[model samples]
Target: MAVNKLVYYIIPLIVLGLIAWWQFGFGGLFENLKGGVKGVIEMAPNVSIGAEEELATEPTIPREHEEAINNLVETIEKMVTSPKKNCFLNYKLLGKNYGTNSGMPSLGEGGTTISFQLKGDKTEMLIAGGAGGKQEVTRLRKEIAGFKPCVIAGSNEITKNFFNRYLGQGQILGDNYKPVSIINIFYDTDGDNGNAIRVPEFGNEPVNDEGDNFEDEGWLFKAEDGSICFFPTNKVMSADDDGLVYGNINQINTKVGVVGSGLDYCYTWTE
Candidate 1:
């Protein structure tokens, strides 16, 4: 029994020694491994240059070059700032620049807005025009779907058709049929075709804006091609009280896709 137990233990020892010899080399395997690990540890710091070991130097620009840079910076600063806007002059709108007139004139004394006389539906337009420009809505709605700034496409003809249908009354007739008008005088003009107007400029006066303050009311007609502008006036007006006028191109539409005919009776007074 003792001899059998010794044989079993000796067999396991022999198998383990063979496995170790096969995995490692014959004798100095552990010593070689220890030397390799030590070599890697010793070489690591030399291979990697850390942040503390980095060398940095300040850059120095020549005097003339530095001056030139400063001047260029100043020029850039000025370019970034817009020329002071004069309310009495034309403005390059940053928005879509639809260039439609705002129905309200800039009146510091009173805030203004545009109100459309809604037909509720196309049937009302047919009843109102009695064969005037009701068909214009078909084309007009198509135009309105594609609105963008400064695009003068089919707007002129549409404007004409719209004006042919509706007269340039200041305020839209309310639910009542009574002729409601603006407190000021409105304008009357001929038809619309390829007309252009430099939009009227009023001094920008800050509004109290406690509530009832609006700069203007206008209409926007966009085309499927993303073309549109603002029409502030109900009708195409040739003149303002200040004798300034934006041509009929700015004539938005009536209650349809566009607005009414011309400028409403608004006096732009400063507060």
Candidate 2:
């Protein structure tokens, strides 16, 4: 009875969300979600989060587990922000060596995968490829949607490989290798979840690359647009031509579970 009622309620909402996306826009879906509703756009009808995204005023993670989550977030932040600066300059940007740091969950694969379990005394540490030995590979990417964990990644060749190889595996790429163009963000379950967006804006470059500038633009930070909005997690129906992504998945975090009954939104670029 409860299951039937649940299904009866969710189906129309999903359809309505899609129709809304088609008619109104991405903003419309969010508006609906904020209005105490949940829905998916035309891409997939598998999403079902409650007031989690909007009303998750407190951290759903157990108080004891808070430390582990903090450690994981801090590590991720370090990797995303400073992983490249320490590497040799030549290979930083072009090399597939600089990207997300340790403590990433294995999406699914042989060596690089981690079993989802309680983060006990281990403190949720994911070593970089070189430091961790083997780069954890995100195999079975097709299983992302079916699996509840929203820890997935997408990008171009160089960006993808670096994120997996170095950050996930701790292995640095060859010399002069380009670092990753990163846009990773974790929605804060505690408070101010709204401000937790990773790459805010992606747009055209106003200034052209001249010889005088010591800081040249590399693929790591370069993009077709100024901001990367609701990424792979964002609904396909709402994504504009520049916001679609279809890269192979890169897994992060071993503590697998839904992001607190909230949609783990991501954007993938498409040709």
Taken over the whole model, the C-alpha lDDT of each candidate is 0.27, 0.27
Candidate 2 lDDT by residue in tens digits, 1-271 = 9999999999999998789899879987678666654324222323435534322221122222233334433332333333233221111122222122212212111112222211322112221111122432222111111111111122333333434443333443432122123332222223212112222222221111111111111111211121111223221211122222222111222211234422121211120
Encode model 1's per-residue lDDT on 1-271: one tens digit a residue: 9999999999999997778778887766677666676566456633323341221212232332233223322322222232321111111222422222433222111111111122222101101011221212121111111112321112233333333433343332221111111111111122332112222122221111011211122332222222222233223233221111234423322222223323222112231
Q: How does candidate 1 score on lDDT?
A: 0.27
Where does the lowest 10-residue lDDT sum fall in candidate 2? 205-214
Write down the TM-score of every candidate. Answer: 0.18, 0.19
Flag regions of model 1 displaced more than 4 Å: 1-147, 151-158, 162-216, 232-271
Model 2 stretches astray by more than 4 angstroms: 1-69, 73-157, 160-197, 203-271
Instruction: Name the lDDT of candidate 2.
Output: 0.27
What is the lDDT for 158 in model 1? 38
